[model samples]
Structures are given as C-alpha cells and as structure tokens.
Target: MRLDGTVALVTGASSGIGAAASVSLARQGAAVAVVARRRERLDELAARIRGDGGDVLVIEADITQEAQAVEAVERTASELGRIDTLVNNAGVMLLGPAAGAPMTEWQRMVEINVLGLLYCAHAALPYLLKAAGAGPRHVADMVNVSSVAGRVPRSGSSVYNLTKHGVGAFSEALRQEVGQKHVRISLVEPGAVETELAGHNRPEVLETIRARFGGIERMQPEDIADAITYIVTRPRHVAVNELLIRPTEQE
Candidate 1:
C-alpha cells in the first residue's frame, strides 16, 4: 500500500482519468503499465511518464477481449516482475433512453464497461495475491472506478448505470473474498468529472450534455487520480474500501 516500488497496471490509460491516475501512480514510485486500444495514445502517456523519470510500460490492447486482457497482465508481470496494484478504469458511457438506444451501443457499453473490468481483474488476481504476501508493502490493491450513477440512476442513463452498479457490487464482493488474503479491493465513485466520456454520446446529445457541464466547475481527471492515489498509498492495515468524490458545486 505504500506504492513505492509497486507495479501498477492501469487500463483505459489512453486518456482521461486512467491516464491521470497512471501518471500519479508513477509519481509515487510505482512502475506503471498503461493499457488501452490506442497504441499511439499509450505511447504518448508512456513518454510523458518516462520524461518525468517514471518507469512505465505501454500495452496497446482492447481490454474487452479476454485474450488481450490476459496478455496485458502477463506482459506487465513479465516485464515489471510483479503486480501490486490494478486500476480497472476502462469503461464506456453511451447514454440514451433504452427504448430507442442503438443495440450496438448498448452491447459495446456492456462489453467495455462491465466485461472489460472483469477480464483485467481475472488476469491480475494471481499476481496480486503473490505480491500481497511477498512484497514489502504487505498488501496488494485493486481500484475499480465506478460512477455516481452506480448509486443513483438517471432517466437517460439506464445501461451506463447498470454497468457502474455492477462494478460497485463486484468490488464489494471481491473485497470480502480477498481481504483475508491481504489483497484490498476498493471502488472509487466519481460524479461528473470533465473528461472525454461524454464524447462517446451521439453528437447532438453530447453537445447538450457538454453545455450542462460547461457552466459548472466539474472535477478534473486529476482530481479522481488524486483520490485513487490516496487509496493505494495508505498503510497496509488501512484499507479505504470505498470513496465517493464529487465537485463541490455539482449536485
């Protein structure tokens, strides 16, 4: 939990909160593996981290694919030698009324947001357990990123809410199962951070939602990154199980 010399694998590291969290973890002395579908973006993030004298690896693969997710964790352990932390930050939000929403978008959200997190967690668990008992930190940690929608669903966000809620539930169960093994599972629920998540929406709807956040001082991605850092850097006996962060001005 100290984060010094820890090996962290962060999914969705191409941009937004994941990218920010990777940088934050790297700054704390963890060797970070950045995973995402965009090779170029991953490279960019890796370069930035390296420029700051942080150890980093760029693994370009779509986490929704089971094989890629497994390969990603394997490669991280092979290259970095061990895995102490996992940040399951890869997710999608295609918000619309379910009745008229495109089936493809719904499936895509489920695949990337729900199944993707599971794939990464499945692959990372073994290494996490190994590190938990062997490393100086004495505990391994998994941080699953959820949304405020996980707790409170809105009319236009049914599927997005479902995926996030599932993440919250999964984190709770995993925590109960893994806590005895010295592996900590935590969930970070963020409310309306200013990020590229909304760009996945249909153009018109994206514009409308953009305007809604445009007036309010929404949280930055780094804000969520800071929350993640706080959780992972705690002492071994202190497991911050769940954290909900929202911008002060936002409802």
Candidate 2:
C-alpha cells in the first residue's frame, strides 16, 4: 500500500477525518491538496506535511459553492500535476426532531453533504479518469465518508439520514459507471467517531446523543483515516469498494 508519485485531494480538511486523512496520505508518498473553508487550519496542516518531507497544497474553498469546488479541482490538477485520489469527507450532522426541525438546517446539510460532494465529484471525475489511465498507479480512487445513519433510519435524524443515504446511492451507481474506466469509487460508513460533527447539532439533540452513546467509546479521526488510506493505497488491481467501520462496543 504505497502511493509514491501520486496526488490526492481531500475536502473538508480543516479538521477531523479530512485532516487526519490528509496527513496519512502524505506519509504514504502522495502529494496532498487539503481543501476546506478555513485557511488558517489548512496552513497549519500544510506546514506539518512539509515538515515531514511530504508535498502538500492548501486549497481554501467552500465546497457548497459549485464554482469554488470546480476551481479547487482545476488548481490541484494544474499545481499538483494530477489527482489520483479524492476523499469527499466534508459534511455536517445537524440532528433534531423532523416535525420542528429548522428548514435552514436541512438546507445546510443538503448543500454541503449532498450538493457539495456532488460538485467535487463532478469536477474531479475527468481528472480521476485521466489519472487512472496515465498516472504512475494506473488507478484512481474516490472515497465518500458517510455515516451508519445512512444505512439505518431513526427518529429525529430524518433529514440527516436522507443526505447520507443519498451519498451511498450515488457512490454505488458511480462505481458501476466508472469501474471500466479504472476509477474506483468507494463508500466509508463510520458508526461513531469523535469529531466536530456532533458539535453542530442542537443542545437537545446533543443530550440525546450523549444519553444513547454515553457508555460506548467513540472512535477517533485517525481510525477512519487508516481505513481511507487503506483504500487508496491498495494495489491498482484491488479495489476495496465499501467499508463500514464501527467501534466494537457500538451498536
């Protein structure tokens, strides 16, 4: 599992899984472009990658905006040379009861979790296809980070589940569409990880989350990072299409 001479673009990279995945991929010898809305965090991440003797590019863009997402892909292709892997990890988890939930929260989730992921994938597909054909590895990878909620529907998380379920559907369909092109599309569904995702929810929702998972130890960002790194660094002929990871105690 080596990525020598390849380039990867990771979105939602200011922190959490995106940040960890960026560092992990860089260590494996890929020039990584870290994309997020926050510039300072990206700068910090870039310095760490450089200090460790890895090539990295910092791309500050709000992926929910279609134009910015397209520009990010173009800049990476022009600057980093070629994109061999794309990790669509930027997302939000705004959970609450469906009946009284704010429409704004639902809109925000759709904008980033669904539309934003779509924007990046659309812009990167051409490059990924080309990279699979001509790059050192002869294969390109795209990993979409979803949640277990994508698989199981529950009360109070109606819209959040809807967005993540959409991710799963799109990934499988695109995987079949691009399999012949050698562009690997994978979906990673994490059960529970300690990240800023939970912090975005309302206080009442937070209480419910805590009460439910209070006894279970949550996984960390690096856990998912390792899974992502595993996917992209596989032998070109081996494609790990789907991975569902969870803490041993999670149910």
Each candidate's lDDT (Cα)? 0.92, 0.95
* Per-candidate count of clashing residue pairs (backbone under 3 Å): 0, 0
Off by over 4 Å in 2: none
Q: Kindly list the per-residue Cα lDDT of model 2 for residues 1-251, writing each as its tens digit.
A: 69999999999999999999999999999999999999999999999999999999999999999999999999999998999999999999999888878999999999999999999999999999999999698999999999998999988889999999999999999999998889999999998998888888889999999998889999999999999999998887888888999999998
- Candidate 1 least-lDDT 10 residues: 204-213
For model 1 the local lDDT of residue 87 reads: 97
- The estimated TM-scores of all candidates read 0.97, 0.98
lDDT of 1 by residue, 1-251 (tens): 44777899999999999999999999999999999999999999999999999999999999989999999999999999999999999998888777877899989989998999999999999999999999769899999999988899888889899999999999999999999999999999999898889888998778777776777899999999999999999888889999999888777
